[model samples]
Target: MTAVTTRPGLAPRLTALTKIVELGPGRLDQKLLSEASTLLTRAGDRLKLSSEHTVVALAGGTGSGKSSLFNAISGLELSPTGVRRPTTARTHACVWGLEGAAPLLDWLQIQWRHRFARASALDKGESQLHGLILLDLPDHDSIRALTDTEADRLIGLADLVVWVLDPQKYADASTHRRYVAELAGHEAVTVFALNQADRLSPEELAELVIDLNDLLRREGVEHPSVVPTSAVSGRGVDSLKSVISSAVSRRRAAIHKIEADLRRLEQRLSQTMPVGQALSAPATVDEARRLGLTDALCDAVGVPAVGEAMENVYAERSSRWVGWPYPRWLAKFRPDPLKSLRLDDVSDEIRGITTGSVSAQAAEVSNAVQALADGLTAGMHPVWRTAVHRAARSRSSQLPKALTEDLTEVAPELDRVPGWWRLLKIWQYFLVGAFVGGVAWLAVGLTVPGQLPAALQLLGDSAALPWVGLMMASVLGLGALSGIASRNFVVLGASRERERLEREMRRRVAAVSENMVVEPVERELGRHHAFYSAMRGLSG
Candidate 1:
């Protein structure tokens, strides 16, 4: 068969495949990508589009008359032919040109002893087959390991393969299943020749051709061109030569071969990727699950203890402002709640104060993360599932440290005393002063005699002993009332402060979850999207 027309976008398709292979570092399957890279390199090195040479290999099973066909097509006795089971032990190359096909033959690794060149003046009609490197490969079923290896190697690299088959062994199961069926997508560069046609009657030859066509169809080759040729009689040699001439003139054998190889690679790599659109993570974290994670991290960061300490600190400061003066002085001796906990220090560095509940909290956070990852990868393929799981756990080792740091950074303003507290403190001080002054006045009246001077008598009459008692009683009553009213206000303020600390702690924990887990998984999903888009371009 002649080579098909050159594909319009072959260069772009190959470039796309190259790009996909380039993205193989940590994202794609290592082994498969490595194989694809090697295939691409080989295709690039072996098949040069401007080389002006087309390598065609004649391959067949034992007793298929492949060597006879090779000689008949080349019009020379270049390949040894006999009635042996496996005639060719090694590959033989017959090049039509003098100098240009040397590099191509060297790539084929054909020994100089086995290489032949056609005479320039033999026949003008044969000039149409110039720049053709015809090769006779060893039998596919050869017992010799070296011969079979050579044949397999050449078949893989050949731009065009002409499968030679004897009429008797044309329908052999091993040949059809192992060889022909494997080249299903390579039909554009493949030709089938039924050799030794002289052995059969004309009617028998026609029937054999029909049977071979049916077998080829079953092998996934649609509309195969099977030529009936007798190498001994040179019956259909011209038709086979015409096919070769057409392929050489078009100079698209290399492109077609490379294109077919790329197609096969795409098929293999597709199995590793998901089928339709790419998968994406949930837009927002699950609220119930997020709350659970926050609670866990709060426990890990000592938020409950911190909140309680915050409330105690608020009440302690309030007492200093509203309590009785004598007891308020002693209140300074009591330790501040936040200072006792060592959380009052303003430092950017994370403290190493180990909490007994952190390990359990860490486990809870890990479980929530695992559940989230599982939900995200629920309907994805196994490959993508593994990727998602890896992404979710990418920062697991740093979760504890990250949560601690964030919680400490977002710690609430526990040291800020409200403005009302200062005003209440001034009122308490004034009431205490008034009580002291009243007591002093009464003590002076009891110790000293009645005033005899005119001015002193008038002042003493105005500030009588009963008047001092009434003033002292009034100061005590107001002070008690003020303390009673402020107690409820202080308690309410402490409760509000505790709630504010809780909110701050929860916000910090939520940020940790997003950074450590959610973002990494989403980035991986983005890579999957890019891979799917690249694969779609391969089909086009």
Candidate 2:
């Protein structure tokens, strides 16, 4: 337990604990939160600021004068007190003043109760102790487990605990280990009373108090106020009452207990949170692993095969635009690459892709993602590591369809005809018309035996036929040059398109990884940080 000077009221502490639960959720320990929640509710319900009653219990081991001290303080024989070992078997409560304390006593589960009225003439300055409900609980180290359990439960519920110790058992191991040692942060609500001090000599009593103080300091109860009291002789009992009276007047025992409870929870939760640093996502995705995953996806999506088919399509289309007119027509017999693969549709439906390769790619991607998740969550808590892994593989089932959709959308861009290709197609058609016309003129001039007809002679004489052949040769040569240029141009464009498609595929893969893996991991890390901050606030 941690000690702090400033005690937070119950409401603020409860609110902070609630925020921790809300912010952390699955990332924090469930059992810890459950226990904290139970304590928070108990504190809220038990501590009523408007109600002037203060519940204090005297908890001690057998032969510790707990019942005797209780009877002396209340000035009534409500609790059984004798030399018999473990005299009190049950809890008994005595409420001061005329005010009603039934609800508070009922909350403490104390059925046997006594009411003590303040005598105005005798208790003139003691009006401050009006609403004190002092209880004498059973011996904490009772022979029966049930009696001990009852005492333990009531001690936990009490806003302030008066630990009554006999001179003989003041340093008992069981008493200190089970009760005093555990109430480290609750030192403000704890009062140590050295009962039966009349038996010891004054010097011995002084020495015993000094020794008890040293023992308590070693037990982690810092600077504890130990009062020497005698239940039989009524020595130091008023001092004990004054301590209780001051706490009651201040009405801060409940707040102190609640703060102590928060401190206890803070100490426990701090162990679970990583120390010295906050959790965050990795700066960037692992490039090599991402590329490896993309390559596997490309194989499944048939990218290499599609790229080859694209080159072939460009070759065939370029031939039609600028190849020798005779063979250019032969290229039309080949099917379009994208159309043959049913990739040209660009519709929402995924078609013509094999499931086996896609499934294999999904498995490969899963493995790569798992590796990335493991690396990211290395040295993390098991709960957070499990969360990161789950986030990494969250959308694995839908990946194949998403990849296929993205590939189909980008596939149609490969078959896009450039403006240059269209312009060259028109030039090739004009050249073909000229070549055919020149051939027709030459054929007629050679086959004609008699004088040529006037219309044909006007077109060109037989001597002009050489010029026609030269003109036709020039057209054919230029057409061949154009075809060569077009092939290179189309091939270069196809290469660039292949690179672009690969880049697009990689981008899509990165998107999937970001959404499915990176984002989820970061969210969990953010929760971890927030939970840590909340714990810090509560602890402080």
What lDDT does each candidate get?
0.75, 0.72
Candidate 1: TM-score? 0.77
How far off is residue 6 in model 2, in Å? Answer: 11
List the RMSD of every prediction in angstroms: 6.0, 5.9
Off by over 4 Å in 1: 1-12, 15-35, 47-51, 84-88, 119-123, 277-309, 321-360, 394-398, 405-427, 439-523
Candidate 1 residue lDDT tens string, 150-246: 9888988888999999988898887887778777678779899999999999999999999999989988888787888989899998999898888
| Model number with the top lDDT | 1
- Candidate 2 per-residue lDDT over residues 1-540, each given as its tens digit: 111223444455567678787876677778987887788777766655325767888988888888888888877777777655443466777777535566666667766433344445136566767778788888888887877898888888888999999888898999988888887778899999999999999999999999999999999888798999999999998999999999888767777877887787777777876534443534344567556656655665556665655555555556655566655566467665557755444221212332222222666566666776777776666776787778767876676667666665556343467788788888877888888887876677567775356435775655765676788899888877777787788778767876776677667756765666666666766665666556656766
Best by TM-score: 2
Clashes of each: 0, 0
TM-score of 2: 0.79
